[model samples]
Target chain A: MVNSWLELGAQKKDTPVKHNYSIFRRNCLMGIVLAVLLMSGPQRSWGQSEKPSIDFFSGFEVGLYDFYFYQKYNVVFNLTPGFKWNMGNHWQLAGQARLTVINQLSNDVRRFYPSMLVLSKELKAGPVYLKGSVGAFSNSRYGFDLKAFLPVTPWLAFEAQAGLTGLLTMAGGWGMSPMGRFTGTVGGDIYLSRWNTQLRGVVGKYVYTDWGFQAEAMRHFNHATVGLYAKWNNIAGQLGQEGVSLTQSLAKGMDGGFKVTIMLPPYKRTHRTVNFRPASHYSLTYLVRGMAQYRDANQLYYTDPEENMRDGWFSRDLLKWGSHTMEPDFIYKGKEETE
Target chain B: MKRIKISYILLAAMVLLPSLSHAQQYNGTSGFLHIPSAEMSHEGDARMGVHYLNKALLPDTGFLFQGEKYNTYDFYLGITPFEWIELSFTSTRRKDTRAVTGEVGFWRKDRYASIKIRPLREGRYHPAVAIGFNDVGTTAFNKERTDVQLYFTNIYVAATKHFGFGGNELGVNLAYRHYFRNYNDKWSGLVGGLSFRPAFFPQGRAIVEYMGNEFLIGADALLWQHVLIQASLIDFKYLNLGLCLQLNMLGKKYVVAER
Candidate 1:
C-alpha cells in the first residue's frame, strides 16, 4: 500500500503543491502575530489578557498584634511591580518586588522585602491539571510547592497540594532558616450549580507540623464572593515539642471567620503592552477570637496569590469563568443532566 | 407652675430633634465628634484623613504633656467594600511625650483598626442600627516595655433617626459603648448626640454629643462632595480639627450632589 501511494504521490509532486504550501504557512504566521498584538494587555477585563501581564500592583497590610502605648500600630503599604512572563511551553516566570512606602513599625523606618519570585510550570495528566512552583513565596517562606486538581464530575472536584518551605525574613536584615518543614493538603469541593454556592473541606499538615482541617461555604456573585470558614487543628504534634503531653494539646485550636473578596474595575480596557491597576482582587478576612483564646492556632499561607474561593481557586471550573461571565455555565449542566 | 415646667421640657426635646450621616465622623466612621454613627458610605467609598486630636480626647495614657498639649495627630484610610460594612486602618502619632516610666519620644506611633456593620436601615418605624468595634485589639506597651495597656478599644451599638422638615433635617443618635479591653474606660458608657443640617446649608452638619464624660460640639462640611473639613470644641473647651478626602474608585459615586 505504501509503495503504491508513493508512486501516485511522486507523479503528482510536480504539480503546484510547493507554492500552495508556502502561502498557507505565511498566512498562519501572520494570523498568530495579529492575535498576540490584540491580546497583549488587560483590556476590558482580566480574563481577556492572553499575553504576558506586566502590571503595577499595590495592597495594604495592618498589623495590630504589636500594639502598646509606646507604639500602637504598624501600617505597611506594599507596592508590588510584578510581571507574569510566559516563557512558553506552559512554563512561566512570575515575580514581584514588594517595596514599602509606609511602615510605622516599632519607630523604625519602613522596610521592603522580595515577594513571590517563582518559576512555575503547568502540566496536564489525563484529565487532571497539575502545577509546580519554586522560589520565594509570601508569608516569609521559600521552597518548592506542587499542586494537582481534578474535576471528576460537573459538580465535584478534588485537589492535592504539597509544599516544602523554610522561614525567610527581611526584618532587622536578611536571614533564612533551613527548609525542612513539609506541608500538604487534600481537599474536595461540591458545587451547587443552581444556587451558585460551593462547599469545601480539606485536611492538611501545616508548617508548624500540626494536623488540621478546614471547612468553608461560599456564595458566588457577579463581582464578589462572600464566605465563612472554620479551621481546627490538633495541638498534639507541635505542643509535644514544647514539653506538653498529648492530653494538654486537646482541642484548643479553633478559629472561624468570614471573608469577602471583590474584583476591582476597569473591568474592561483598551490594549497596552503593560498595564497599571490595583490588585485584581481584594480579599478581606475578619477573624473571630473568643475570650478564652489568646491567638489563632492555624498558621496558613497562600501558595498562589490568586487562591480564593471566588475563583474556585483550586478547581478546574475556574477555567470556564471570567471572559464570558462570572458564573461558569458550560460545565454546570443543571436539571438536564439529572433528567 | 409644675405644668409650665413640663411644657418647657417637651419643647426643649422637640427643638433638639435629628441629622443625616455620611462617613465623616471625627474618628472616621459615620457619626459626630469622637463617636461612631450608624451610617456608611456606599460600597467602594474610601476616605483618607488627617485629624488633630485634642488633649482631652486622647487616650488616657498619662504623659508629661497630657494636660498641656492638644497636638497628637492621626492618618487613616477607610473603605466600604460592602454596603453594610466599613473598615479602616489608622495610625496615630503620639508627639512630644515623656512617659511616666522615664521614656521620652518625639514621635511614637500607634496603629488600630475599626469596623462597622450596619444591619438595619432607618425607616419611618425604626431608626438605623449599627454594631461597631473601634480599636478592637489595640494594646500598647509602656515606656518600660513591660506593662501593656489597651488604648481606645471600644465596642458600641448606635441607632440614628433622621427627621426631615422642609429640606432642613435633624438626626438623633444614641449608643452604648463598652471598653472591650482596658483599665481606663473614659468613653465607655451611654452616649448620645444631636445633628442639625439647615436647609440653606445642605453641605454641613452641626452636631453636639455627650461622649460619656465630656461634651463636644462640632460641625463638618463636605466640599465638592469629596473634601471634608471638620472643626470641634472638645468638652466645650479645647479645639480639634480634621480634613479628609473621600475617593470612590468603583460603582456609583459615593455622594449625590443635591444641587
Candidate 2:
C-alpha cells in the first residue's frame, strides 16, 4: 500500500507513457516479493524454502582385515543404525551406531558406540566443486576433512583430498588420542559410460604415515558394483630403517584384490520427514596381503562411509550430469531437443 | 500349413517349461547335490536358507577340529548379480570335540565366501563351463605350525551338458576340484554328477555325485515355486538335508535366455 501511494504521487507530477511503464515494472517486483513471503510460511525467511529433513538407514558393517596378532584374520560384524539430518543449504549431519554382534577383532574388542558423527557441506563454484566435513568419522578417527575437484572433461576429473584426525577407540570405554596426524591425496578418474566402467588412481600419504598409490578399475550395474584394486606403499619394501627404492616397491610389494558391493531393494523411497529402511548397499572387499605386508604400514583408513567407485553418492552419471550438462554446446542442444 | 505351425508352438513350450523347475543344491549353489553346474539362475536371483549337516558326511575328508557325531545347522545366502557370476556367503560351523569348556557352544560358525564364474555358455556344439573358488579371503593361520588349520578351500572348474531323451531331460556335470592348505588331495582330481528329470515329474530330480571317494545320492524337489527341498544320503550312511527359499530380485520370472 505504501508503494502504491508513492507511485500515485509520482503520477501526479509526470503523466507520461514512460512513467506508466516504470510503475508497471515496480508492481511486478512487489508481486514476486509477496508471493515468496506467502510460500515460505511464517517460520522461514526468504530464499530458504528447503526444510530440515531426517533419514534413517539400516545396514550391517563388515570389517575384514588381515594381520591379527592372535588370529589369522580379524572379522567384525556390527549392526549399523544410521541417522541423518539435512539442515538444508547443502549441509548434513549424519551418525551411525556400531553395536557389535559378532567379532574376531583385535583383543575381541566389543564396542557399542558412535561409528561416525560428522557435519559436511558441499558447494559448487563454476566448474569447481568443494566439500568439507568436521567431526568424528569412520575408521576410528575424529577431525576435519576437505575435498576439491575440477573436471577436465565429461569423463575425466582430478581431485585433491586432505584430512587431520586421531585415534578413537570405544572398546572398553571412551578412549582418545592426540589429534596430530595429517593425511592427504591427489587423484584422477577416467569414466567410460559406454561400458559403465571407472578407472581411478590416488597417490599420497595414508593414515599410517605410508606414502603410496592406489588404483582401481570398477564395473557398475544397475544396483551392484564389482571392482579390482591394487595398492603400493613406500613402506612395504623398506629394509631396516632405510626406505627401499620406488621401483622395488612397485615390483615386489604390490598387493591387490577384488571387491563386490550390492544395493538392497527399495531403490525408491517416499518423501517423508522420518524415513527408516534397510541398508542400501553392502560391500565386501578381499584384499590380498600377508601379515608382514599388513604390519608394514600400508594400511588405509576412511573418513566418509559412502566413498566408493561406481554405486556411490558421486557416481559417473551424477558427476557427468553436473559438469557436462552445463557446457555451452550441450546447453544449446538440450534446448533444441526440448523445443 | 496352419496345423503344422501350431504343432511347432506346442513343441517349443514343452521344451522350455523345465527351465523354471531349477532347485538349489545342498551347498546353496544353482546345481545338483554337491556339484556346481555351469548353468546359472536368473541374473538377479537371490537365495537364502539353512541346511542340516551331518558330521559324519565327510569323515575322512573333514576339518581338523571335527565335532561330535551329530547334526548341525548351517546358514547360507547366494546371489547372481550377473548372468555369468554367482556369489555366496556362508557361516558354517566346525564342531570342536575337544571343547570340554563351557564358555561356548559345541560348534562355532566361521564365515566364508565363494564365487563362481561361468565364462562359456552351452551352445549347439559346446557345453557350458565354469570356474569357481570357495573360501575366498581366508588367511592361512600359523603357516608353519598346526595350531590353526585352513580346513575348507577348494578351486574347481566345471562343465555341464544337457541331453533330451524324448520328453525326459538329463544333465551331466564333470568337474575337477583342487583342494589347498590342509587336505590337498581330499576332493582333488576329477568328479562327476548326474541329474535326471522326467517330463511327467519336472518338479522333482534324481541326483547322484561322487566326491572324496564317496557317493552322495539325493532327491531334490521344488515346492510352491520358491521353496527347495533336498534329502541326500552321503556314502549311504549319513543323511544330509537342505531347505531354501529364493526369488528374482525384481519379483519377476527367469530371463529370456534361460526361459
Candidate 3:
C-alpha cells in the first residue's frame, strides 16, 4: 500500500530518521527502474491512435465572493474537485481537488484545500497550447505553474500563466512562514457547445502590485447548468506601514451572481464508456454590487458605505468519468476510483 | 574523526550523482516545520524539514531541528551538478547558543557548501543567481567561521483575463537579497511579492510577501491527492506564524502532447 504509507511517513514526527530511510530506499529503487524501463521500452499501439485526441477533465467547483473594501462584502466560498488526464497523441494531463470557504460579509470564516498537477501541449496553426504545472498547497507549500494558449476559433481561447509559490519551514506550524509570490494572467474562453454555453474573461496583474478582473458565463441545459459571475479587484502601488507611505493602498469592487447546476447521472452503465456519464452537481450564488477604497492615491479614505448581498450554496455527489478508461473502476461501490 | 568520515563521503557523493544520470523532469516531495524568533533570548527554537526535486535530484534532501540553543539537530543536503549547477551541505550539532552556559553534555559540529545559477532557460519571467559557503567548526569560544552568500532574483508577469478572473492564475514577483560578512546582518532585505492561483485552486495558492520590512502573508492548501498545507503570517520588524507539510514525488506527467 504505497510502501505502508511510506513506512508511516518515515515514522512521522518531523521526519529525518536516517534521511527518511534513504529517501524511501531511493524512491523504491526508482520505482523498480521506471517499471523496467516501461516494461522494456519501445512498443506502441495501445488504444486510441491517429494522434489528435486530447480530452481529460475532472470536476467540482464552487465559488462566491463579496469583498468590496471589507464593508459587508465578505462571502467567499469555494469547492474545487479536479482531474484532467490526456496523454500523448496531442498531450494534456491536468488534475485538481480543491476546497475553500471564506465568509467575511462581516468577518471570520476560512477553509482551504488545494491539489493540482497539469501538463498540456498542442500547437499547429494558431490555437496554440503549451502548459506546465507543479503541485503541493495543503500538504504545506511548494508550487510552480506555466501557461500559453491561443485558440481564436472552435469556440474561442486565449491564455497565459506564470509561477513561483512558497512554504517550506520546519519549526513553526500555523502552516509555516514562507510566502513567496509572483503571478500574471490574461484570459478568454467562450464555448457555446450548442447552448451548453461557456463564456469567460479574465485580466489580472500583480507586478508593480495589484489589479483584478473576472467574468464567467455557463449554461448547460438538459440536466441543468447555469452561471454568471463577475469580479474587479484593485491595489496598484505604494504600501509601506511602519515607515509610512501607505499611498492610499487602493481598493475597488464589483460582483454579480447567479449559479444553478443540477446533474445526476449514473444509474448503471457497467461498461461502454466514452466519457463515463455519472454526475451530481449543485450550486447557488448571489452577490449584488460591492465596493472598496481605503486610500485613493493618498488621503481620501473610503472603506465603509458597503452594501450587503450574499448567498452561496454547494453540493457534489461525485463520480464522473471519461479520460479513456478501458475497464477502469477501482472499487466504485466501495469508493476509491482514480486514474 | 577524519573530517567526520569525509563529511559522510561527500554527502553520499552529492546524493548518488543525480540518480546516476538522467530521469527527473518533475518529481517533488515536501514537508516542513521551523519556528524560531520568540523575540530573541534564544527563544524556544524548533525545527523540522524535508525536500526532494527531480531531474537527478535538482534540489534534494534537508532535515533540521537543532534547538536548545543549537544543542544538536541539523542536517541538510542539496545537489544539482548541472542545469545551472547547485550544491549544498549543512551539518550541525551545536557549539554556541549565546556562549554555552555550563557545559551540559558538550557538543560541536558544522559543515556547508552552496552554488546556484539560472542564466535564463525556464522562462515566464526569468532571473536567478545564487552563491553560498559556510563551515563553522572550532568550539569552546568561537575560532572557526567561514561565510559568503549572495542572491538576486526577479519575477513579474500576468495572466487570467488580464484583469477579469476565474481559474486562470495571475502573477507578480520581485525579489532581492545581499550579504557578504556580518554573519546574517539582520537577514538582509527587499523581498517583493504577490500571487493568486484561480481555476478553482488548481493546487491552491494565495501569497504575499515583503521581507526585510515585514508583511508576509501566505496560503497553500492542497490536502491529499499528493498532499500539501503551507501557511504563514509575518509582520516584519518581528512577529511570525507558520505551518508546513508537503509530499508529491514523481507520478503525474504529461508535458504537452495533445493536438
Q: Cα lDDT of all candidates, in order?
A: 0.62, 0.63, 0.34
Clashing pairs in 2: A58-A279
Q: Evaluated with lDDT, which candidate comes out highest?
A: 2
The residue-by-residue lDDT of candidate 2 on B1-259, one tens digit each, is 5634443444343334452446566456787666667878776677788887766453333334433344566777787766798877775665553334434333445555678899998877678999987766553323345554445557789999888776677888899887655444556778888887777667767778887567887767766668767767677666677878877653465422221
Residue A151 local lDDT, model 1: 75
Any runs in candidate 3 off by more than 4 Å, and if so which?
A1-210, A213-233, A236-339, B1-68, B71-115, B118-181, B184-259
TM-score, cand. 2 vs. native? 0.66
Q: Give the per-residue lDDT of model 1 (tens digit) for A1-339.
A: 101222234324643656535644554454345335323423222332134545455545443434344544446555655665554344556666567666554443235656677766555546766666677766666676778778787678888887766665554356454455578999997777655667888999876556878888766655666666777777522445576565545434556656767766555544344656555566777555422231334454555554556764333322442212343322212321100
Q: What is the TM-score of chain B alone in each candidate?
A: 0.80, 0.79, 0.24
Per-residue lDDT tens digits for candidate 3, residues A1-339, read: 101222233245445557645654654454345334333422331222222332223334343232322121234454545543444433444444434554333232225433444343332322344333344322233344445656566676676666444333221212322223455677886675444456777776532234566677754443334455655455422234343344333222344434444434442233212343332344444443322221111111001011001111000111111111112212235333322
**Candidate 1, CAPRI quality class derived from DockQ:** incorrect
Candidate 1: Cα lDDT at A281 = 68
The lowest-lDDT stretch of 10 consecutive residues in candidate 1 chain A is A330-339
* Per-residue lDDT of model 3, residues B46-97, tens digit only: 1122222111111111111243222133344333323343333333333332
Worst 10 residues of 3 chain A by lDDT: A306-315
Q: Which candidate has the highest DockQ of all? A: 1
